[model samples]
Target chain A: MKSRIFVTLKNGVLDPQGKAIHHALEGLGFAGVSDVRAGRLIEIEHDENVSKADLEEMSRKLLANMVIENFEIESN
Target chain B: MRAAVIQFPGSNCDRDMAVALRDVMGADTSLVWHRESELSDGLDFIAIPGGFSYGDYLRSGAMAARSPVMQAVIAAAGRGVPVLGVCNGFQILTEAGLLPGALMRNAGIRFVCRKVRLKVENSQSIFTSHYDADEEITIPVAHHDGNFFADEATLDRIEGEGRVAFRYAEPVNGSARDIAGILNDAGNVLGMMPHPERMIEAMQGGSDGRRLFQGVMEGLIREIA
Candidate 1:
């Protein structure tokens, strides 16, 4: 079994890196760029017996800092 | 007072913290490696020093925060032990959930390294008791991901509870609300980007940081006495 965790900055939080990337794209003469936000995708391999609760626990404990980021888990 | 400094694989300031606690704070101190499970019994304080712990892999202090020794440190903190995390240590504290907020890349994406002026926001903490509230002190800050970030409500709660221990007197890093340092809800755990251990002596440019360690030592000594 495997799970993928998507960690992203919450809405209304300042994404400085994303902002820099947007600025760079504009500097390169690229148009139609409304916004850019950066985040991390972590893939984990776990046993089938692992429950969704367990994966959520992992996200809460380490993958995403609940203070500044939000995490979503997808398992297959 | 018995103090222990946790040394991760790449932690360069462990010795400096040990020296600050032992020599300046006059407390019996020991260096506990990242692999150690058990700290010395009856430890009064734990110092998590700066430097690139595990090369700051995954994120700043991410790998080091999961090391075996941190479990013991977290347990100790739950028992009311004073834990001070400086720079990389601050990142680890946040990663380990011992403190709130994440240290993002500097707002300008630069590694800021210099002496920064910080205002002691809360003089009543176990770590900041020696300083007057709002007093400005200069301390060296050397870090790449020292920009602190948290949601507005959490920030407000921390401020309302007086958990914000230090704030930058001037703009240094693009920290939210210019927060240079903060304490956990327990008030025993402090995570800050400034290197207080580096400023413990006049020969090191200033002794402004000496009072923090000394204050903790005195507070703990009084508690156990």
Candidate 2:
């Protein structure tokens, strides 16, 4: 079994990297760019017995910093 | 005062911090590696020295925060031991949940290295007791991700709670409200982007940073007495 975690800066958090990326897009002549917020994705491979709670705990412990980032988990 | 300096793989300033604490403050200091599961007992203070920990891989201090030794440091912090995080250490503290906010990329997207003026916002804390409030002091900051970020409410709360320890007098990085350093709610943990360890001596161009260690040492002596 494998689980994927998406880590994103919370709403209202400033992401300068994402903004720079947005500006780079504009500089390269790409128009209609809305906004950019940088984030991370982690894929975890676990055994079949691994539960959602375990993955959530993983995210809370190491994958996401609750002070600034929010994380969601999806198993497939 | 007994202090421990946590050393990560790429921690270049651990020795500098140790020398500052040992020579300037005369504190009994030890260097603790990241793999250690337990810190030496009865530690009065812990200094997370600045450097590109883990080569600043996957965000500054991100990998180091999960190292085994951090658990002991976090435990010591919860026990009310003073923990000071400078530069990359600041990022580790935030990553360890010891402090709020994140040190993002510099607004100019370049590594800034120079002496910058900082305002002593609150001199009452154990870390800044030797300085007067609103005093302008120069400290060196060298980092690529020293831009501090927090939401408005949290920023206001941090300011309201008197947790803003050091404020940059001028814009060095694009930190929110020019916050250069801050303390945790319990007042035991401090995370700041400026490198106080770099400015502890007159030969270092300024001695403004020496007072922080002196203040903390005095506070620890008083506590021990």
Query: Who wins the TM-score comparison?
Result: 2
Q: Which one is best on DockQ?
A: 2
Candidates 1 onward: DockQ, in order: 0.56, 0.57
Q: lDDT at B38 for candidate 2?
A: 98
Q: Stretches of candidate 1 above 4 Å error?
A: A1-3, A45-53, A74-76
Clashes of each: 0, 0
Query: How displaced is residue B170 in candidate 2, in Å?
Result: 1.0
TM-score of chain A of each: 0.92, 0.96
lDDT, each prediction:
0.91, 0.91
TM for every model, in the order presented, reads 0.93, 0.94
Share of reference contacts found in each model: 0.47, 0.53
Q: Please provide, for model 2 over A1-76, each residue's C-alpha lDDT reduced to its tens digit, 9 standing for 90 to 100.
A: 8899999989977787899899999999999999989999999999988999999998888788777789999999
Tens digit of per-residue lDDT, candidate 1, span B1-225: 788999998999999999999898787888898999888768988999999998987688888888999999999999999999999999999998899889998898779999999999999988999999989999999988999998888899999999999999988879999999999998999999999998998999999999998788889878988
lDDT for model 1, please. 0.91
